[model samples]
Target: MTPSTEMFDPATATIAIVTFNRSNLLSRLLESIERMDPKPGHIVVVDNASVDDTTEVVESFRERLAPSQLVYRRLETNTGGSGGFSEGMRVAYELGSTWIWLMDDDVEVIPDGLAKMGRWAPRFKSIQGRRYDYDGSEFYWQYRIAERMGIPIPFAPAGFDESGYKPMNSGCFEGMFIHRDVVREIGLPDPRFFIYWDDQLYGWLASRKTQSVIVDEFVLRRTREIKQWDMGIRHLNASSNAYRYYIMRNRAIIKRYYRALGVYNPVLFGLGTFMTFCKELIRLIFVERTIRGTSNLLRGIRDGRKIANDRSWQPMPPLATTSGSAPR
Candidate 1:
């Protein structure tokens, strides 16, 4: 079924936020949402397993807001970004919402964001048959190829405009709107992603199913700075190790699956994969320079290559929900 084409109603859209352990940021985001011109029908917050006092903070707001104004769920373990958003989307769907607005806790949606979405809804939906529907299928194939080759697909642009507002390559979860029908067709975020790159995967899937856009009218305020890891002992550390494991492992799986379908372009794919690995190696040797840097980088590269070459690798563990902690 397609999303309803009826008049836009704030009561039919549910705004969902996925948060980790950032209580301070979550509070700010909630405050911003509270100030929207047309208030959301419902605000659903899914807390990944957090050790912090996120539950207490959310409870404070629950006490103040009317029952219909807000809803919160705290998972038992950390489900990373994918799991949190998956659960949040499920909640939104169950609420009978026509649209779902997904955002990270660290992002503060502009006051008119929701209204702006309503304004552009018709324009987007109108293009469904002519542009959105046809292009979506083609875009998915292109995206799969790009991902396999390690090419960073620009998210915001979605190939719509040269305007610098490209939808992020994979992390649109920070601030994205989902039409109900899109979710019905595609289902939830792939839980295997756990954390990194989950947003890109979802955006790629949604881009095909409906008219998704990175609206110029609404901008989410990002509160944190992302630090790039250098090549060194730090790169070989636990956090870095886990990050490498997922990125390499997932990409390999994506590559092998496409190859089996005879859609793989080996030359481009190999070049892309080689370049990516080399870049990582350089980053370790020069940028990070930790004591175990080279060794860790090699290990990650080896594992990634094995997965890509053999086309057989064990899947990562299923994500678990963490206590409600604020995102950082």
Candidate 2:
């Protein structure tokens, strides 16, 4: 069947998908995008050094998508989701998209998801307060304040409390729209974060520039094979090292950046980093049984201490690259 072009909007928006070897899931996600209410002006997919026939699969769907609605780029090396999305966002920005929609290959956008998200774009843009109040108790406190202040708290599209905004904390990359201006200001995801924490970092950094509101609408369904590593505890363990390194290093960097602005609070930053290190170290020993995990934990703690003490910001090298095919 020839795809309907009636609902497609060619004016101001584009959709970008970042994929790494998930051909079957990507096919489904593309089909779903084809059925959205206000069809995307452009659809660009980045194949992140997939060894599989993912490139061929996307090509096969070209005929099924509207002309100019589909474009695909292949990467020579696996650049992780952060790099892939960074490159994709850059391409979308250059394509004259006023707003770029970002998603993962495993997420299927609902029929009206894009339209719904577009409706809330103004709310996101008009946001007037801190993306997160660094001194506001805990993260939840900020959510509470946002709600009380008449700001829409972030929430999962469904199956989560609606009274508070919780940042997308998992691999749920669908339903996020990035304004061209925000991209212009914040640049792209930090390439140093080769894997885990990139999404959170994006939201955290972007929140500084644009208002990111979690709308109370289900926009996408993430579909992929369930792996043992995906279970709550195991998933945490799998990312423990990257988490330790980035959390320690980046927190210090952020704290130092604020300090230069006279918002300095070395005591708080140091205390927080130390507490986080101790907590993660305990988790490593009790939950994750690897000596490497323990060793990394200590290394992260030592590095965090140095950052906290010196109050100097230095970017670390990207985490060692791994073949995406490794078992999750």
Candidate 3:
């Protein structure tokens, strides 16, 4: 039998993209969407108040992808990727989307990619699709959470069998397909995260409510190219200082979630955080080839300590119980 509660109309699925000043990349993504066999019914672009030709680029595609209702919600302030996805998902939900596809502006959906993803919607409430790097190599995304550290660790069994799908707990916003019911239960991605670890926690929370899985279906191609430190099994992309900062600082935020879930052990998590820090530090020196933002990393740990110390911290309330700007 089909999913008894949720509907699965490929046309009614909404693709929620979070974009910034990358208009060229945005245009390419929109063009890819325009080519879908049965195009998504809605396209919600949450602009993080980009001060560029982003508006012009989005407006240009508005008419060409007609009847699909391309919406451009430019935020008053730059809320970063975390806020952008949270806002984008909220908007799609209010637009009556049964399944919301989330992604950044740097990728293009491959031919029939959406169809491959849609094929399993009736059986799963949350799904993650595979992606390709700029060179067409499979981007290694298989991950399982390191619960003690509240971080993602690469999983074993790199390849799947004939089933073409495998169970997963890690979440990558680039190609996560989730149902409205999941949102109703967990609310939006915490905007306060503002950057890093947001998708990991969001996907983890979604997994707690449903059988989340990552399929072998090739869904999209990365358009932007960045130098990565080849690590044999996977590649580590060099990141900006901002990425370095938020990623380090977000550890405390993750701790808050695990604590709320009653699976926290201070000693274990504390040890895991240090190991995680050391690992990322190696990545920086090896990939970026500099000891930049070392202070920022240390500062993040200090601030995270404060957050963990706070006794009043609370998780996002369920959307079914409250109302905020679902889309603005």
Candidate 4:
């Protein structure tokens, strides 16, 4: 199959950002984007109906991104990150964007980040860029998903510098650069997941049609400091209760996709889920110094099982040319 593809162009790449109530962070991100020497041809800001000054923040960038299309879409409700990205990507695609550069509002694009990522586009349909944490440390991002087990492959590369790119099946939306071809193949991201695990599955789907890799170029800077549990060898970010719930519940959503691919193993996936529970439990108890969110985590697993067992939950359909709506 001659892969359905498009020529890579930084100017025609649409920068898609999903922002909630974080107007402050969005402002900073917009400022960084404005500094890009070779700017994107379009920008799509998907606001999850934030009740803050997010609208104003987006408007402020209109003049800065002159002549370049700047679209600000405010959803009627807060659909979390998943729905936001889905809507944002659909809008970008409908606008005839060649490349959709997706990210959260919390990260600031480095001046040359888009350029560095653009270099890999002619060869790769899907690309991931390196990110620096708030503490200025390179984030651990390169890895592949164990589709059968529904987990990450253990002992993946921590970071890469010497190589131009490392083969990775997984993708981080915070700095994902993908051609519209992948979107045409895989469709917009699933929005059933209100938050967690959507990116991994979406990335996995993209890898099916094209070579997905993590480019060695630094592209983003995470602005907010997160609490980390130092394990002496490596540090792990602590999680919030909301994240814990979705992370636990979203396992079923992931399994749904795996099942479709004929790689889902009930026994192996059960073991993987067990391991995740144990790891998160330890993190909650020791790293967080509190088991307060234990109930939510357990509840999530229970809900996930129900979701998996339910017969009616369907996989996301391919995106329509003009509409981004799905059954609620």
lDDT for each residue of candidate 2 in 266-310, tens digit (9 for 90 to 100): 566556556666656655655565446656656655664566578
Which residue pairs clash in candidate 4? none
Model 1 deviation from the true structure expressed as Cα RMSD, one decimal place: 9.2
Model 4 CA deviation exceeding 4 Å by range: 1-7, 159-163, 320-328
| Runs of candidate 1 exceeding 4 Å displacement | 1-5, 63-68, 125-150, 153-171, 228-241, 256-266, 279-328
TM-score, prediction 1:
0.71
Candidates 2 and 4 compared: the better one by lDDT is: 4
Per-residue alpha-carbon lDDT of model 3 for 74-157, expressed as tens digits? 999999899999999889988877789999999998868878888888788888988999998888785578767676676456
Candidate 4, residue 172: the lDDT equals: 71
Pairs with backbone N, CA or C atoms under 3 Å apart (clashes), candidate 2: 153-165, 154-165
lDDT of 1 at 40: 76
- Rank candidates by lDDT, best first: 3, 4, 1, 2
Model 1, span 1-328: residue lDDT tens: 3434567777777888988899988888887776777877789999997788888888777745443368889999888888899899888877777777887887676677777777655444211100111112211112222644645542222344544223322336766676666666666776656765566656655555554545444345665544444343222212355665565455565465446545567788777766656655655555456444445545655765776766354433222233222111
Give the whole-model CA lDDT for all candidates, comma-separated: 0.60, 0.57, 0.85, 0.84
Number of the top candidate by TM-score?
3
Candidate 3 matches the true fold with a TM-score of 0.94
Give the alpha carbon lDDT tens digit for every residue of 12-118 in model 4: 78899999999999999999998986788889999999999999989988998866779999999999999999998988888787788999999999998888877
Top lDDT prediction, candidate number: 3
Please give the ranking of all candidate structures by TM-score, highest first, separated by commas: 3, 4, 1, 2
